[model samples]
Target: MLGLRILVHSIKLVVRNWRVALRISSPLIAVLLVFGVFMRGSIAGVATLGPDEGVSWLAIGVYLIAQTFSGTWVAVAWHRYVLQEDDSGAIIPSFMGRRVGAYFMQGVLIAIIVGIVTVVAAAALFFAFSGLNSLVLAIVLPLVIALVGLWLFYRVSPALPAVAIEEALSIGDAWRATRPYSGSILVLVIAMAAASGVFGALVELTVESSTYLYLVLVMVQTWISMMVGISVLTTIYGVVVENRDF
Candidate 1:
């Protein structure tokens, strides 16, 4: 019940401060728009050359690098603004340097660790259940793996806010800080996922079949979701780690 309250409070916080959310997200929106308009054609051209082609690989690399930097910038900015009450806007000139790189590297490190663990667990399950029905294994195993991944992610998520504030936090520190609130974190994660899924379904059902329109709607949905996620995590971090009142 406490977890639910925190989730509700987080949602209210984001909705109540919509202007701040928009200002913080504006830089990301602008960057995405520019990339879509200027680089999409070139990337698409390279993609048409087939997956095995050198130009295709180049395009993928470029896209990934751009996404990593842009995503890190947005996440760090949101964390700083919401968690620290830093009034600095989305495009803080000073944040574009080492701070952005540190944030990006931290994310990459966490992702790599989570990916490895998930892969290893799935492989173990496959071998251990060699005699299980193939269809059941195929469907159930992936869901189980996904749940485990989500659990692991929540365990270390506190480190992300730590990085945002330039704090020296290890994975162990984050894991332990969140241990007391694990139940609440689980509820929040599941609730957020369900909400996002429903929102996407509604968009699919009501929107016209125009590619550009769909893309725009999806981007908007993503931004809103991002804001909610940051808010929830920041709130949790403040309450659990810093002993701050909600």
Candidate 2:
């Protein structure tokens, strides 16, 4: 089956790219380590909001926006520089500013769309859960949610490479071209996400007030996020390149 083939091919590509990512990420890893060591005490002391606790909505909005922008930058760098396609080597950093800006904007756009979908999905889930005694609704609601989530991802997954290569500003066009490849893309994304989760848990486990532990946690989390972002962009690019119809 096509899905099976995609899965196998993606795994192979991921394996091949793993070493390249490690090499590309070395400088970033070192910087994070140094920064973490210096900032550990302050960062560790900063309290995070607990679940279900109310916080400033404005602050929350700003935080989410920043996260989205950062995620986009990571995605862009992975595709544009890390993989390098047929290029002799990674692109020069002096000219990479434009690429980074474009990717950041794409990330912001995708984040907004994802946010809207998330809100709608949450509201729907709440209503569905409340009315789940109705078998028809129970059976239908989950399918609807899954489809919406899938469609949202399909719309966003290809934007990284599109933005990197063509510098596309139109997210809609990217979505259209990426549709046929959505299923495989999603599988690859989920696999990378799982890998990210494992790395995150490792960081969480070492969290403590001690400066050493705090530094370790921050350094680990940052590079892991970068790795996940890189894996995602590379996987999506490989999927589209290897399977034109995908």
The best candidate in terms of lDDT: 1
Model 1 agreement with the true structure over 108-173: per-residue lDDT tens digits = 788899999999998998889879999979898877788778777877887888888888888788
The local distance difference test score of each candidate is: 0.71, 0.55
Residue pairs in collision within model 2: 181-246
RMSD of 2: 6.1
Model 2 Cα lDDT, one tens digit per residue, 68-175: 454444455556553455333442222356776877766667878877887788686867587566775666665556556645765566676766766543667666
User: Candidate 1 regions off by >4 Å?
Assistant: 35-64, 89-96, 206-208
Clashes of each: 0, 1
Q: lDDT score of model 2? A: 0.55
lDDT of 1: 0.71
Give TM per candidate. Answer: 0.81, 0.63
